[model samples]
Each structure stands twice: as structure tokens, then as C-alpha cells.
Target: MSNIVSKSSILILGGSYFIGRKIAEVFEEYGYSVSILNRGTKPLTSLNIEQITCDRNDTECMKKALNDRRFDCVVDVSFKDSSWVENLCDTLDFETVKSFVFISTSAVYDIENLKIPFKENDKLAENKYWTSYGLEKINAEKYYTDYFASMNTRLIILRPPYIYGENNYAKRESLIFKHICESNPIIIPKTNPKLQFIYTDDLAKIINHLFKNNASGTFNVGNKKSMTARDWVNACAKVVDKKVKIIECDYKSLNRNVRDFFPFFDYDNVLDVRKINSIFNEETPIETGLSNAYKWFLDNKSQIAFKENIEKNICEILAKSN
Candidate 1:
């Protein structure tokens, strides 16, 4: 694919989060005029991208930002609710905007039959009940897909599965990281389930490729490989040269932190990336990306601020005990 978007002005919502910041960084690296719209709470000192302060959920604020100025493309990372999606499209519903990229999730797919190589056209559970978060995203995708179907604007939907990397909020990768560093027995669900992980940088690169290629479709982005939860933990321990015990506890015996979503651990939810491969040639491998990510955590473990978070979480747990 030719570099169609050589130097275009880009807007990123939720520009301060893990994946969001990575996307901003990659775009800025490519010489794109990047403007980040967020709450401005998460301070980033090194980024050369322009920062815009606005709560995207507020329709008036969203309209004010793009009132006169128009961007070549807008990547919405914080667009969660249906209202935000509608108002966002209304604000940027223009002829000047070239494309709109939505950072969706693979959670929108049916989890019942999640086998390998889950294609875009694969059958999904249409009548499935979406949770508050999932429903909003489902509706948001429809709004964008249908709205941009007639317009000249290209809509790119990226469904990333289990996004993880250095500085991730989900803390999914932290499970393996913390397990490898410490010697205490790590409690894992007894059931072994296969899941996918996408390093933030890798995901950002794929999104960049789509923008450059003017690709418009739904693409499931993640590491080309999938591994079971047990395998990942064992691999991490091996890499760090740590000897630890994996206590396999049933769902009933799990702690509050472990029991909340323990039922889903047995569900296989590996997202297929064939559509992404067909659209873009480059894809990040799991082993290389995870190795780099593990090294990053080991090098910067002290500066990661997991201690403060742990203290707060412990307090929450204690209060619940009371």
C-alpha cells in the first residue's frame, strides 16, 4: 500500500490511555500533525502532539473543538457510549474529513464458537445480550458503519483482542509480569483457556497501516499467535528464571479479585487476524513482542507505580472483608 496519508492532521480521543498514547506516539513519529483530545488528567511530557481538552461525552464540548477546524482523520479511542458516537459523528460529519477510525474490541464477537482464524464474515451471535459497555460499542459501530456508508468518509473498525504492553491499564499482562518477578505462589484458575494478546505498539502500527492504505473494513488485530493462560504463565516464569508455584483454585475457592470474572477464564476468545494480514502485510509476532514487553517491565518495575496501586487495591479488599 502506498502512503496515501503522508502528512495528514489526525485527532485521537482518549489520547492519554495505554493504547491511545501509543497510537498518538506512532502517528507523531510518522510526521503526522497529531492532536490529542482527552480530559488532560494523564500528563505526558515528551509527546510533540497537540493536546485538546474536552469531555467527548459532552456534545457541546465536542462540537466546540471541531467547530471551525477539520482534521484529515479522527481515531476515536474513548468512544464508548452510543451517545458519544452519535454526537461525534454529528460534530465531524463533514466533507472535509477523510476517514474515521474506531478502536473497537473483539468482545463484540460471539464467544461461543471462538475457534482459530475467526474471519470477519464468520457467523456471530446476533441476538446475544451485550452488557452496558458491549451494547454501547455494538451500537456505536453500527452508527459509524451506516453513517459513513454513503459519505465519502472511510470508516475503519479495528477490533483488538486483549490489548497488552508496557503501561497497560487492563493489567492482563501484569498477571504474568508480577508472577515472574515475585516468588510467592500465583493463583490461577484451574481451567486452561486460550487467549490473544496484542502489544500496544503492534496494534498502533497496524492502525497506522490502515490509515496509510485508506483501508475501510472490520479487522481483528492482535498477535498472530495465541497461547493458553497456563502456557503463558509458565513461559514468563521461565524467561525471568523464577521458581514459583501455580495454585490452581476452583471458581468457588477464588478470592474476590480472582472470582469477579473467573468464569470467563475457561472461555476461548482468540481473535483471528486474517483480515488484517490481507489488508496489511506487517504483523507483530507474539514471542518477540512479549519478550520485549517483559524486558520493559523488568527494567522499569520500580518506576511502574504498581506499589501505590497495590496498596489502594489492598485497602479495597480489606474494606470488603469488613
Candidate 2:
């Protein structure tokens, strides 16, 4: 007997955190029956969605959990390497799965040789800066595209840069928020590199739109505009109505990991989203998104695990400058 599944039924892999969580929430709000597969470490806040607790790394365990189950669409936000995608394809009944969406990264682009406003078809190179993370994602993308094509299944790949908004565990916005709240100087690299960001909510909407329209292709997803590092810090400050002191220092003088000291480095990582914009109209402005992020930070500051020691490093830089 064939398995019966609703047209709107969707399954999200790694829906317990960040982008995946938002995707699940958006699908649920749109009245889609949502199911999530993740290791039971993080408890899903949403009670309505079906939860499958299993580690994707464990092939046998994952296969057993999703053996008979099937869905119209599968969104994979957890795949880190090509092996994981291979494992999933090997285990799942592809005939029952119509669409497979993979959340990839803009890091897959060759950062050193990349031009401004990178397009979807731009050549991808090994990410020397981020090292293995980007290379692995690129491999995963290749595997998914090839595997799904061989199976004659629909595949959608989304590469987004610097996804931000509420529930962002990454120190992207929160680092600035912590400084702004405490009335500290926002230290930045002297180069004042341009950066691009995509709101998590906006990304979620894009995923939903693509799934509904049955869009299949590799697309670069990001806001239409780009902002400088200083502008990003100022925007965060503006959201909280805080006066910020901007201190620009030489990148080499900081003597710390760029990722640790700066939210974004002195590189133009902007993505060309004309293709996606042609289909999805709603783009969240940085101001609005930063404001919303600040609101969430205020309500959940205590819970946030502040990972970077940006403040202490800034103080040390100041002491040396004196």
C-alpha cells in the first residue's frame, strides 16, 4: 500500500536551532503539518510539531527512526558533510519525498577571488578563511544535487550569508547588543569592510515560498543592500536608543581572531539576490531586523551564552593605545 501524505506535510532536519527552528515555525504558522529530526539534546519549544529524536551521524539509528515515515518535502538544515547527505539519501524512500531543500552557506564561494555582489552561478572555491566548514558544505551541495538529479527528485539549494534575527545563538548581533546595552565603545577594524545579512524570518519566508512554488536551483539568498561594519554597529545602537562610541583600530593591532573581535571582517561578502527577489518580494530592512533582534536580546539576555570576549579585548586595545 502506498503511504498517504498531505501536500503541505514537511519534515525538517535539525529544526531545534536557529534557522531550522524558524523554518519549522513558519511552516506551522502556514498550517503545514511539521515534523523534525534531531538529537534529543535540545528540547523543541513547539509542542504541536512531531519530533524524531535520533543522531544523523548514526546511520543505522537514523534509518530506523525514519524507515517507514515519508513526507512531501524535506528541509535539511543539519547536513554538515557529504556523508550525511549520502546517508540520508541511502536511508529515505526518495519516491515518497518530492522536494529536498538544503540550507547551504555563502562561504561556499571563493572568498579570496570573489567579486562584489556574487551571483548564483559564480564559481565556488575552497574557503581558505573558514577552512573545512565551507569546503564540506560545498561537497554536501554537490552530493545533494547529483544524488537528487540521479533520483529525478526536486532539489533546492539556498546559500545565505550572515543570517541574523531573534533566537540567534551566534554572536553576530548579540555582541553588539551587549556593548550597546552596557554603553561601551564599539571597536571596529580600520578597513570598515562591507557586510551583508539576511534576516532569519525573511529566510524562512523564502523557504516557504520556494517550496510552494516548487522552485529548484542553487540561489544566493540575502538582502538587496549591503552595509559597512560601522553602519552595522550604529544600526544596532540606534535600535536600543543608545549612544555608541565608535573606535576604529588597525586589524593587525588587535592581535586576536577576526571572528572573535569583529562581527564581520574586512571583506565584501555581499550576495546577488536578484534571482530570489524576482520571486519573493518581501525583504526585511536591516534597521527593522536589528530593532527586532534587540528586542529579543533584551527579553532573553540572561539565557544567551555570550561566547566572545570582545569587550575585554577592546579594553586591552584601548590600554595599549594610551
Candidate 3:
């Protein structure tokens, strides 16, 4: 069935998200039929796309939604559970699916040091039962990679460190812009710790590259250059031409509530992107991305409804733990 003129019918697992939506946009622009499997709360206007609301945790629901149809590719940006992925591998098999792309995280790498860049073959985290959110993703990647090793379904694992841009769920740019607009000083543990960041649009381009080239390996998507936390804050400030002080503080002194969830401030694992650069050389400058993100924040800040679920969930969990 594969031919030079063949177009892929792609099923994006978390197509409502920033990165997932951008990938769908790029795929549709290139004449591919894209469908999404999400919560179906977000409205999409793409004529060539369809969305099926299915909770990712429900195995029977997934099998029902996918059993009647086959997809050329499945881009899973929300596959947090290893069991779900393994079940899909067994059910879908190689005969029904061609490619599987799992959006893993660079969080799978050890970040105790801020100097070394992580390679694609670096050791994954060993502890899945503890620590940050990396373990779930790590297990999912391993399951997919091993499950598809003997099948016709080629596995592609994309590990992105930190993603920011318009329609971002992380609210990283919004957080920075809010502080900048309020003239409130941003705080960092140190001015020298570096981190990797990639804009959502740029990431979409990389996913498109994989689609065209049939790249079948684990690739890292991040800027070639790493930026210090202080530099990033200052860069955002410079982009907006806002004068705001930056407070330097120890990790321990930051609000315990915020610090408990955001422990990356104390570590940096720079990603080695030579393999990514070998394919897509056009990189979005951090300064330019900051400017665009700041503009988006300025234009849409008033429309954003702040949800307290994160705060509520954190407090509830903490209270139970105590």
C-alpha cells in the first residue's frame, strides 16, 4: 500500500496540546489526513480532521475507538502509561499501523550536573516508582521501542526538554510575561545554570521532517545553544523592553509550594542536538521566540482563565502526605 504518492492518515493522541496541534497543522498543510484523540473540550476547525474523545486510561475505550479503522501513523504525545502503549502494540500490531511516534521527555536524563550534554543513547532513569514525572515517560518509551523492534511498525521517540510558545499549557512564557508586566523581579537559584528550550512551531517543523524522511530513531528536539535561567529571564525582559529586577535566591528559599514541584531550577542537563541539526538546521532564535511569545501574552492575557486545579491538587496531596 505504500507508494511515493501515498498520503498518511495520522492519529494524534493529544492533538489539542500546543505541540500536538502544531504538528497536526503542519501535517494538514502538507496534504495529510489528521485526526485527534483527546478530551474533545477544545474546538478545532480543520476540515480534514476528526476528533474522538477517549480517556487514555480506559483500555476498552481505546480498543473500541481504534478497532474499526487503521491509521498510517499514530503520534502519541499523551502516552504517559506504559501499560496503555503495550496494549496498543499488542492490539494494533504491525499489520494495522506503520509508524508510532511517542513524545518523551529529556527529563529521562540525569540532571545533577549543568555542564554535560545528553546524547540519544544516554542511560535512562532507573527509578520508575519514585521521583519526578520522567519515569512514566521512560517506561513508555522502552515499551514502545521494544514492542516494535520486531514489527513493521517503526518506532520514533522524540525527546524535548522544555517547550514554549503560543497555546502552551505549561504557561512558562505567560509566567515570565506576567512577572515582566507586573515589574516583578524574576527569581533564579543561580545566574549560571543552563537549560534547553524549543519553541512549539520549530518543534512542528522537526516532526514534519520525520514524516517526510521516515526517520526511525530517537531524536532530541531542542535549540543547539543552551541559555542560563537568568539569561532567559533577562532576554524576555529585553524583548518586552521591560525593566524588572531579577532576584537571585537559593533553591531552598523559594516558596516551598512552588519549589516542591519545580526542582529543575537546581539542575541542568543540556541536550546534545547534533543529530537533530543534521536534519533540520533552521533553528528559532530564543530572542525571537521570546518576542513572539511576549506579544501573544500581551494580546491574550486578559482572556486566559486561571485554573486552580494544580494548586488544589498539590495542596491536597501534600496534606495527605503530611
Candidate 4:
């Protein structure tokens, strides 16, 4: 059995949305006292977590919220940069903290992103699509790595590919599932981009995996397999027990932004999980993850916005092209 104390405390930098919410729930289930720090936007519905409502970029607010506080583990699940990292680390009472986990994306390796599977040691560059998002994360990763080395702290950075699961705010799998559920026509590009994905719940479990094992260093956390957009749509269609009408066309060639209709970029984003899987082994297939997501959509579809304006625009573009 693993030797981590389930009762240890943790502080999540952002715990209201998809990834952070799932992680907070998992740690709480493991008996960890969970606390979340974020600008109070959404209320934490399910977990009994302590909330520190303040923007992390506000150095004074962060200091006030985290003064003299300690955590066994701290995970930055928010979209933050090196400045946020510096402010949080400076404000945190690391004297009692053991591990700090930063959620970096596979976008870090985006210059060569479409060509090959990125391992932990891959070269990071600015992604044309993700742009500055990748560069900022690389800087944050560097800062955390350098900062933690001087202390008795385990800094673990996870470079995950496109994450999908229940309550995902991103209009990815859920959007397709909704279209399929509503018997709507779905669009895709001719050169179907293959992408790697990780389940949100599995990622939450992986965070706890590192926290328990005290694992340090960066690791790619995702399923090693890759699936094209059509294959992905077909998988969602299978779960929904609905046949999908997939129209393959180069949206860009039509002078239409692909994102106006499609969810993922026009390139593959695959990650090599051998480093993290060698330790955590928390890969959940899309088939399984989509099943749960479909069930949640059925129960809470009212809560999910289908982006009607974008849908209408996509139809107009496709109709005119036809």
C-alpha cells in the first residue's frame, strides 16, 4: 500500500472549474484538508474546502490570504505565469510545505507539436495557435524548478495534452456529443488532426499520485495513443449510440476560421506519458471518459452552453461553400 498520509492538507491555486474542482474532490476523498485560492467567481459546490478569494497576481492580497499558512502539497491548477508563480511562492509559508505541483501543458513543445510525440525533454517554443500561452508556461516551469531546488521541496510539473472529462468548460468532446445528441451535422477539416487526450479525473488522481509518492521533476501525463478528429467523433457517437454526419472540408480554405466550427486546432498535440505512467499509470481512454461526460451532459445539459451563435455561423459558412 502507498504510504502517504491521507489526512495531510493541500492548497489548490484554482479549484472552481473543471480540472481544479475534480482535483479538490479527489484529495478530499483521500481525507486531505483541501483549500482553494482564486478570485471568487464560482462557488465550490460539492467539496468542503476552505476558500481564499483573491487574485494570485495581487501580491499584497496573496500575502494576506496565505500568511503563516502551510500545506503538505500545493498545486497550481490555474492558468498562471512566472509572475504568479513568484508572488505565490513568496507569499506561501513553504516552511511546512513538502511538494508543489504546477500544471503545464503539452503546448510547451508546440514548435514540433504536430510532427512527433513530445517527451519530457522536448524543446519548447511558441505555438502559432497557442502563441504566448506556451512561452509563459515554460517560464513558469523554469521559475518553479529553480526556486524549489534550493529548498526541501518536491516541485512536480505536469505537461498534459488536451484534457477532457465531465463539466469541461472547453467546447471539445461535450460540444460534439451535444451535436450528435441533437442530431446536428458536425464539421471537420480534410487533414484530420490527431490529438492525444487525458481524462480530468485521471489527472486529478495523478496529482495525488505525485503528492503521495513525493515525486519531483516534470512529467508528461497523458495517454500515449493518438486519435484523429473523425475517430474521436465516432467514439463519442458510439457512446451516445448515435450515427454522426461528419462533413470533411478544409475550413481555412473556405476562408472560414476552423475554430468557428471545430473545437481542437488543425494540428495534432500528442504527448509521451512514459515518464509519468512509469510511476502513476493513470491513463483513462476517451471511450471511458466520454461515457461519463455524455451521462453528465444528459443530466446537466441545461448548464452547458452550446454556443448557438458560433453554430449558426458555421452553418452559414458551410451552406455558402456548398
Candidate 5:
């Protein structure tokens, strides 16, 4: 992270998963110096980036891993716990960091009476689906803002809805692909809830743009249009060039939860993208993103190990035909 290397240095907190991995690759491709700090569980084999192996919560390890290195930007991609934010910041050389970016979630918004397009200034309260997770994200944002305010370090918060694309380990896209590919019925709720999504590479581009512009503020990043469950299924189906069977059931009538049989719940969480779009508007369309995801699933199908219970549960629920 020292200026000796000469390229702009960016330190990523979690750099092995979908969003973090995409950001790392994007930065590296554009000739930026990139470094990753995370537990040595997942390896970014494709990129030859410097990786620091340590638990983020370990104060001693954090101090040793970071040392006194300085970075042009510090990106927080997987800070689910506020304590982790405090632990990392407390251990870091704040003055050495030029800017900070925290990857927040759309869950920070209250679910009830949600704005059609959720803005950054919308209400933030606990909801059943994301109560603890959302609250923790809110706290993390607060802690980072409060901590950096006194230091005058530029801080940016990005709240994104469902992040999807190639190599998504969340099973949201792959689950749909699995059902359609296997000729299994895709069960969905009667209510069609529109949800927002952001492609992995598009997000990477946005972050890179922000870094280049030295932007700092809270932003809701996603595609302007919303996609319903059927829209998602249709996109994946088109990738395979096949028509599929769909079973829409009343979610409330079922004893088991709708999420037990599906990846996304029957609810809307679309985000407003006016601010981000005004800055960087090159967004990947839903059809293109799903096609990319389908290609990745085809390549990694044999390697993907799905929970048998989830598949079986989908079948069981479809049998009742409720």
C-alpha cells in the first residue's frame, strides 16, 4: 500500500465473493493496485493480487496485517457486523486512507409502505425479513460516518438490492436455472412483487467510476427498472431457449413459508438509481445479466452442490398445488 509501487492503491476488506471478486478484477484490469484482506477460506485464483489472511475481528491480527500501510481507498465489501467496522477502523491508520466505501444493502429500508423506487433518504427501520441484518448494516454505516467525520476522511455508502450475475453463490439465479433445466415446475407466489437488481460487472464499473471521481456520499445503486419473479424466470428460460412450467400459489395459505420453496420472498425492494445513474448510467440489462449467469451455471453445474432439501421442498410444495 506504500506509494513505492506507483499505481493508485485500493484495499478491499472482503475480496473473494461475487461483488468483491468482481470489483477486484475490475480494478486490476484497469491497472490499479489492489489488495485483499480476508480469512483464507476462498482464493481468488484468477487474479494475482496481494491477499492478507486474518480474521477481521482479531484486533492483534488486524494490526499486524494492515501494519502502517496507506491506501488511496479502503472498500468495505462484507462488513455485516458493526463491531467488525469498529474493529477494522480502530486498527487502521485513518489519516493514511484517502477515501472509504461501505457496501450497504437495501434491507436498511423499512418494508412497510415502501416507496415505489426506494430513495437514499427513505425511512430505515427493522422489518421481519431483514431485521437483524438490516439493523447491523445501519449501525455499520453510522459507525463509519461518525468515526470518519472527525478525521475528515471522505466516506461513501452504497445500498444495493439483489446483486446478481456470473459466479453468484447465493443460488438465486442458479436455483431458477436448476428448476427450468430439470423440467421441474417453478413455483412462485400469486402476488407479483417487483424487485431491483444490479449486475456484478456493472457494480464494479460504478465503484471504479466513483474512485476515479473521488465521489463521497450515500447512494442507492441498481437498474432503474424492476423485475418480477416471472420476469426473472423468463429471462433465465430464454437463455436456454425453452418455455417452462410455472405454478403460482397463494403464499399466505401455505403453512410453510414461500421462501422455503423459492430463493426470493414475495416482496418488493426496488431501489432508486437517479443519483448513481446521473453519474454513471451504463447499466447491464436484466436479459443480458441473466444470460451471463446462465452461461456460468452451465460451466459450473457439475461443481455446484445444492442443498437436497431445498430441491425436495420445492417438489413437495408443488405437489399440494396450493
Candidate 6:
């Protein structure tokens, strides 16, 4: 084990989960003293990291667990409500913490009149598709900005579109991989909207880069280039070395909720990632990232939980179309 350095001390809230888990591993590998705070319900897979068991929602519990510990950076990936941010700000001592990085979503943008490749200064509104989730995230961003400004703490906010990598709880890549493995036809909406995806490891690297440099500001983070939904599905198929047919159908004709049925959401939420890319030029190609995600899904297929009944509904639609 590397000697823990005080300057590199880091705390990750909700580090037991997907994106946060990857960040914890990367920081630990880089010889940082990594500590994770979670509710202790999920299993901690990362070795040689400090674990603080406490509910982030409970202000008192958070204070008790993290009052004495001071970290150079706090990477928060589990905050959903604005109140959660308020609680964390009220409890943690910002005097010692150099930076606070929040994992925000691109859904905060108003996609109704959104321009493609949105920049950091782009106008944002509550996401219509994920109404409450987007609104709350917006609120959380405001709270963090306001509270951190008062304390003169550096704040970095990352708005990533779709984050896919190993150990993903969301059924995004796994759903497509499952159908491709079964030799089932993939169903998608007729419109081939542009989509953006950031590999979890790459996101972790971005967080680490921002912290090391003490970069502060809201930045849009994603792959350099955006691909259409059709290309994305094809990439997934190529990853598994399987040839699967894609059936694009009109959602109205199928009389089903397209967003709920398809893997990619209806909006073309691509972010202009030049700002982050300028600092760190480590953009993982779509093919390479998708291949890694497919491999992980195959290895952990049995443990993954499928949320959508896409196979049954897609097969029925295909049969009816025939």
C-alpha cells in the first residue's frame, strides 16, 4: 500500500455505487487517502479505503460521522435534493476542504429549444422528461454554488449526458447487451437523435484532474464527438461480435411510451466537452467504451437486474409489423 498523503485526502459520498465507485478506485490507485461515506446497505467492493457509514440525508448522522475528518476534496455523487446539499454544507467544515465537486446531470437543460452541443453558459431549465430529478438537481447546484461561495471553497460542477461503464445500476448498456446476446431484434424510436456518453472511468479522471488543478466552474463533460442512436446501437452490437437487426418504429404506431421502452432517451442531450477536453485529452472512443461495458455485462449478467420489459414488447411490435 502506498503511504497515505494528507494533501491528497479525499472523501466521496455514495462511493459504493457506479460512478462514485470508479472515482474511489482511481483516487486510491493514485495513492490518495480515499474515504467513502454511505448508508452501509450496499457491499463495499473497493479494498484499502476508509468507509464511513451514515445517511447523507440525516444531517445529524453526517455531522457525527464526518465532523472531525477534514479532506482536501469532497466529491459528492449521491445528492438528489437541494436540502441534501444544504445539510452537507451546514455539517462539513469547509475551512479545510479545498474543493467540492458535484456530479450533476445534463437533464438540467431545457431540451425543448436546446441547441446541440450545449456549452456551460447555455440556458438551463427543468428537464421535462425527468421533471423532478432535473428540478432538484438545478436547486442543488444553486445551493452548492451559494454555500461554497460564502466559504470561498472551489466548486466544480460536471453535467454529463449518459454515464455508462462497469457496475452501472441503470439498465442502459446491459439492456442492449442482453437482447444482442439473445439474438433478439433491437427496437428504437424512428428518430435517430444524437446522444452522448461518458465512460465512468473517464469521468473519474475528470474529477481527479479538476481537484488536482483546483479548477472551478460549471463545465459540460462528454465524448468529443456525438453519435446518433443508430450508430450507438450498432457499436454495441459490434462489441459483442454479434449481428443484430435494428427495427425503428414510430412510437405512436406502437402505442407505447418510447422513452420507457427504448434504451436511449428521446432528447438529443449532447454536451460541448471542449472545455474539459482541453485540460485532459483522454477521450475514450465509443467503440472501446461500449466494448468494455458489454464485457462487464456479460461477466455479471446474472447479477444485473433488468428494469424494462423491452424484449417482450419489442417482439410483439415486430410481429405486429410483420
Model 2 residue 275 distance off true place after TM-score fit, in angstroms: 0.7
Question: Model 3 off-target regions past 4 Å?
Answer: 1-6, 113-115, 126-132, 253-264, 305-322
C-alpha TM-scores of all predictions: 0.84, 0.94, 0.86, 0.94, 0.95, 0.95
* Clash pairs detected, candidate 6: none
lDDT of 5 by residue, 210-318 (tens): 8778789999999988888878777788887888888887867877787888788678878889999889898888889889989999999898888888887887788
Q: Per-residue error at 241 for model 4, in Å?
A: 1.2
Give lDDT tens digits, candidate 2, residues 91-163.
8887877788999999888889878888889888786676898899889998888787777568999999899
Pairs that clash in candidate 4: none
| CA deviation > 4 Å runs, candidate 5 | 1-6
- Range of the 10 consecutive residues with the lowest summed lDDT in candidate 3: 254-263
Could you tell me which 10 consecutive residues in candidate 5 have the lowest summed lDDT?
A: 1-10
Error of 1 at 191 (Å): 2.0
TM-score quality measure for candidate 2: 0.94
Over 4 Å off, model 6? 1-7
Model 5's alpha-carbon lDDT is: 0.84
Per-candidate clashes come to 0, 0, 0, 0, 0, 0
